[model samples]
Target: MRDLLAITKAIADESRLRAVGLLDGRELCLCQIVEVLGLAPSTVSRHMAILGQARLVESRKQGRWAYFRLTEDDAPAEVHDALAMVLASLKRDKQAKADQKTLKAVLKIEPEELCRRQSDCKC
Candidate 1:
């Protein structure tokens, strides 16, 4: 029950949902997520933390960069089910399609350059 509650809450917001959608099949640097969501790094960090707590995602730090990906098959059944539902629902969403396009552009930029650009932001 607690796990279910956490998963539901983690995905309740639009930003978080889009974050999950963005992570469907690939790992992403924190900066990539920030660029796609157009949210502050701190904000996206918090959102990813919540998703992590729900076991809906996994993360690791490589050097100074943080990367996040959807949980794998070894995750608990509840998590797998939740992820399947979320991904299926997002499949036809207009915003999710737009995000995919934006993510493509973001991915074209090198991760280091992306981080540097983000650091240069006034926000």
Candidate 2:
């Protein structure tokens, strides 16, 4: 029950949902997600942490970088079902479409470059 509640709460936010959408299948470095969402690294990290606690996503550390991907193979049935529902529901959303487009461009930038750009931002 606690896990179920956490999963629902984790996905309640728009930004977190979008992050989940971006991570639907592929693994992405922290910087890539940061760039796609245009959010501070700390903010995105917090979002990912919530998703992690829900067992909706998993993270790995490689050197100084962290990468995240959907928790497919071992995710509980509820988490899997919730992910499917969210993905299907957002497939045609306007903001999701824009995020997808931006993600394409964000992916083109090397992870290091993305991290550098993010660190240099004054906003």
Candidate 3:
């Protein structure tokens, strides 16, 4: 019960929840996730670490990028299932919809373009 609470606390942040929700349909590179969330790499990585520690997300390194996804081992059957339901049940606001659309646009670009776009971005 305590562990479950801790996991919930970690994911309680809106940014983290958004990140988790995006993990629903596809695996995302750190760069992609950072762009989607419009957060500093370190900030995004920290949120991911919290999620990873809470068994709410999983990570793997590929070349120069760290990719994330919803993995089987990340959560128990019931917990994972519940989180999925919760994510689906939540209302996606106009801002969220717009953010998703922006993410999709950025995803269509090459990694080089992504890196270039993020080169000077502090957050």
Candidate 4:
């Protein structure tokens, strides 16, 4: 029950939902997500932390970089269900499509260069 409540709250915000949408089909550097969403690094980090708490995403640190991806098949059934709903909803969303376009461009930039472009990047 607590986990479900956390998942519900984690996905309640537009910014967070957009962040999740950006993460679909690939793992991304934290800075890459920040670029796609055009949000402050700190804000995106907090949003990701919430998603992590809900077990909707998993993250790891590699050197000075952090990368995030959707949880894998071993996740709870509720998590898989929630992810399916979000991904399906995003499929028809104009904003999500736009973000995907932006993400494509962002992915072209080297992660180090991308992180350098973010004013609030801690790495």
User: In candidate 2, which residue ranges exceed 4 Å CA deviation?
Assistant: 120-123
The candidate, 2 or 4, that scores higher on lDDT is 4
TM-score of each: 0.94, 0.94, 0.83, 0.98
Pairs of colliding residues, candidate 4: none
lDDT of 4 by residue, 15-76 (tens): 99998999898999999999988899999999999999999999999999999999999889
Q: Write the per-residue lDDT of candidate 2 for residues 37-81, one digit (tens) a residue.
A: 889999999999999999999999888889999997788899999
Q: Rate the local accuracy (lDDT) of all candidates.
A: 0.92, 0.88, 0.74, 0.94
Please give, for residues 42-122, the per-residue lDDT of candidate 3 as tens digits.
888889998887777889987777889875654676567656764674445555566678778977987656766785433
Give one digit per residue, the lDDT tens place, for model 1 in 43-81. Answer: 899999999999999999888889999998888899999
Candidate 1, position 47, lDDT: 96
C-alpha lDDT (0 to 100) for residue 97 of candidate 4:
94
- Residue 55 of model 2 has an lDDT of 95
Error of 1 at 109 (Å): 0.3
Highest-lDDT candidate: 4
